[model samples]
Target: MNTTHLTLDEKRTLDYLESVKTRLSQLQESIHFFLRSINPETTPGTVAWTELHSKFNVLIAKYLHLTNILNDPRIAFNPRNYTVFPFEPPANDQQVQNLSVLLRTKLFPELEQADEERIKEGTIPGLPALPPSPAPNRAVNPAGVNTPVGTADEKKQWNAYKLKVMMHDELCRKADGIFEQQRDMVHTKVRYESDDGDEEDD
Candidate 1:
């Protein structure tokens, strides 16, 4: 922030350092958040599935970038004073290799597979997609009313959330009105039957 008289290269170096430091802190926080939320023994199902996946993805991305910059031969950046994270600050080359394997080979693959399965099953996230209704003349769109599939995040959002809320309220009000009319009719009929029974008994 105080690079008033520094050279252009010095400014770039400082900026890079700041970026790495910020990313490291974020990586630590995201890792801790996701781990704590997903740990079955600690807080099972505490976090939403989408939230957990998103956070973990961010953590992985930041970790990989941080490690790449730190290990770059050109930069030769040392992380001895950097904040420690779940998958960082390895003591030896073997440990670093193992960490990469654990994440890339083991953990990430399984998680991504699970995510795809969930998306197909419409189990979690923003919402599930409804089945396409058969059309008489035209074929079904396949993209149902609320399908949250695809790459763009715009596809995943509840585009009709407000509209749905308004429709729900309107239906409830109409149903309530009809229900009250039926209840009143039933009550009047019961009263008339009771009066007739009394007269017959007399």
Candidate 2:
């Protein structure tokens, strides 16, 4: 894609998405640290739980808003085809996935509920259908395994290219090895046959 020709709106969208990703990472890190610091022996009271829950809800709302914005089909990264902008991988894959799960399970339904309320109130013009909400992850993984973050499809494409190259190299090496082995076998058989013929002649 010709990333150089990106429009102002596209650039702004990308920037906004990047900022959201950064904030999500920070929020996840904070939550993890807080959970780690707490002791199970001193069980969290209702008030403490409520406070944590509220904070989590706020984070999830923001995450869902940003994620939905990014998920707009118009903004997706495409190589040499759809998008004029290049895709970049986000720093925090685990955080993104966790945020995605939180959005899908809790935040998305809440948003839909809000949208229904808006429609009832006659605030928004039309009920623009959102992308189908995904199912939540049963358990989130810890930071940084191989889980893809922002522009995951782009990463997949790049990975596919790399895999193809690796496979080609492997096949070439294997073919060369096999050819050498066949050549050696043929040479050995020929030499043995020649010697046997010579012995017979003698």
Q: Global lDDT of each model?
A: 0.53, 0.47
What candidate 2 gets wrong by more than 4 Å, as runs, is 1-17, 33-47, 78-202
TM-score of each: 0.31, 0.27
Which segments of candidate 1 are over 4 A away from where they belong? 39-55, 76-202
As a whole number from 0 to 100, the lDDT of residue 202 in candidate 2 is: 100
Clashes of each: 0, 1
Report the CA-based lDDT of candidate 2 relative to the real structure: 0.47
* CA error at residue 178 for candidate 1, angstroms: 64
Task: Give the Å error, residue 53, model 1.
Answer: 5.8
Number of the top-ranking candidate, with TM-score as the measure: 1
lDDT of 2 by residue, 62-160 (tens): 667656665666755421121111112233556345322222233345655665455335354322212221322201111222543336554464344
> What is candidate 1's lDDT per residue for 33-92, written digit by digit as tens?
677678874464557878878887888888998888877767633433221112113345
